[model samples]
Target: MKKLILTVLLSLSGVVAATAQPMCCYNPVLNCIATRTSVRQYAPTAIPDSVTTTLLQAAMCAPSAVNKQPWEFITVTNPEVRNAIKQAIPNSHAAKAPLCIVVCGDMNQALEGQARDFWVQDCSAATQNILLAAHSMGLGGVWCGVYPNTDRCEALCKVLKIPANVIPLNVVCLGYPDPNAPAPTPKDKFKPAKIHVNAW
Candidate 1:
């Protein structure tokens, strides 16, 4: 009985205690994670410098492999440059956003040997952190891929003059949500069937 009570107390404190039943809590961080969604349409209003700084700080807080911290960022506000990048990837939301943060993986800072590609994972985690930070601040963002598509990465590097040691992983398009744009409901992504306990 004491153990069950302790479990209930932990759940209320936003800690995930082992249980098959649905747990309840009011953690703001968890709420931010759960509610965050891609905002493809953005208003023309510019994001303030202070806000941009905060977003970047949040990105840098992401976990990295062996503390490699291999991420680098390029901020774009110029319309001509934005348009040039748009021509490279037609589906990118950056052209419409007031701020486009190009997240890159710095190979120079990456792990060696079989873990060489861990920079990609590190930068991806950073990108997600940026998006969540934006959402928590009432702004919105979308992730647009760049690497693996060699042609797109090359075009982006040419426009931005990216270093040879850095590879553009993705561009995070950010701005205030367009008031006229329809609000999207957060998707129900939790699937009990997908959860494999103990082993596969």
Candidate 2:
């Protein structure tokens, strides 16, 4: 009887250790997600085409509604074009970054009729993947909103000469962060009060 009790305790301890191991380990994915912060100021250094391609690949890997994959990405490196975009959307500081990715949702690629509304959610997930991938690659980025605001959306379309079927969702400014920039504080947003057991 004592031998069986000892065996059970050993197994329980093993389970506890297994559960605690992840909290103490160096998890790169979790680190990337935790350290990702919106960096507005950037260095003059330009991001290479290879890195940009990798980021876009990461974006495209995001899940879509019914696999429609209605997202489109446009990388802008031209100062003139960036300046024009900044002028159109005055709140955006995208001109400062060496690279600006305009994330769009192609309405023509969406499902027919009312079901097409899922494109916005699909594009949002893609945008988040781009930001996370940029952070993982040691680059900083900022997401500047564009869609849901008719005026801002129209301004971007006019300046970039975007096709009517494609709508700009947001601009993700990407670059090497300025060395003098301050570090971001960790945001512990987990709230026990917000959680419900089984049902709300």
Candidate 3:
């Protein structure tokens, strides 16, 4: 009789323990892994300011070299600036989204031999944070490369009046998703001939 009573108590205790704790925030890390997709076509509706704030906060949390945090974000939401950004990215389809984030890296903080230009990696991490945060917030977005193309960079510089120290890294087009687009599947993990184990 005592054994059965103890088992019931243990079971009840387990249930109470499980129900006692409140649910936590949506797992940002898991959201980052599962729910990310490049969303080019956005719905006409504008994203809420609170959602945008969460995304920017995520970007700010990204790791930086020596804590320099050499990244700057320029948001273009005005219709005119959005139109100008659409024109700037020759490869992108018409950016009809309500907002775009220009991720820029400061060249002045690129220390010698320390992670081979932290600007690129640091900015990339920030961009990834923005992407993940957007996904978590139920917003659609896509990252468009911009820096390498000198013509595009120059054009944006002139348009946005960016200083010389700040170099454009990428542009993120963000807004509500237009429709149910299929998520991209993971690429094959098979290694190629170039991938050598131990030694080349």
Candidate 4:
């Protein structure tokens, strides 16, 4: 009810975990993980600050390598800024969402030498936490990669005014799922054959 109808539009448009699933049915955490899906179509209403805070708190709780939590999050709600970022990447929906959280790695805070690559894993874990947290909060989001792609990284750096020491890992596009869009079936990724007993 964004363009067609007026709902109370806040600054952080939020909600839309799963309309099909009953709220009383999930075991909170497990429900979030199991029902989570990548949402592209979103309502334009803004989310509450408290909800955003919860998402960030969950993200920061992620474990890091060598205790080096070198992740940085840039929460974007400005339409112009989001559009600018969208233009920087191919097939990016960052601009479409009501809020775009850009997760970055602070290389300066990362471990030294051979362990430098650990920042990637650390940041990735943080991203996953955000995604799950969003779902749990009844919000929909998708992870848009940025780190490994040189063009994207560089472009984002310029757009976001990121310093030389920080690297944007990915963009978490978030918003309330559009009620009108058809809900797709959630994928079942469990693979018994891939499991190995002690080692592969």
Give the per-residue lDDT of model 1 (tens digit) for 1-200.
99999988977766434443332236778788888899999999999999999999999999999998999999999988888889877889878899999999999999999999999999999999999999999998999999999999998999899989999999999999999999877886888899999999
lDDT by candidate, in order shown: 0.90, 0.90, 0.80, 0.88
Error of 4 at 57 (Å): 0.6
Select the stronger candidate by TM-score from 2 and 3. Answer: 2
| Maximum-TM-score candidate | 1
TM-score of 2: 0.86
Residue 83 CA error for candidate 4 (Å)? 0.2
Model 1, residue 87: displacement in angstroms? 0.9
Runs in model 2 lying further than 4 Å from the true structure: 1-26
Better of 1 and 3 by lDDT: 1
What is the alpha-carbon lDDT of model 1 when measured against the actual structure?
A: 0.90
The alpha-carbon deviation from the true structure for residue 170 of candidate 1, after best TM-score superposition, in angstroms, is: 0.1
CA shift at 155, candidate 2, in angstroms?
0.2
TM-score of each: 0.87, 0.86, 0.74, 0.85
lDDT of 3: 0.80
lDDT per residue as tens, model 4, 54-108: 9999999999998989999999999999999999876779778999999999999
* Cα error, candidate 3, residue 190 (Å): 8.1
Off by over 4 Å in 3: 1-28, 112-116, 180-200
- Candidate 3, residues 1-200, lDDT tens digits: the string is 99999999999999998875423235657536554778877778877778778888999899998888889989888888877877888765335878888999887776557564777888899999999888777787888898888988988887788999889998898887777656555343334786988999
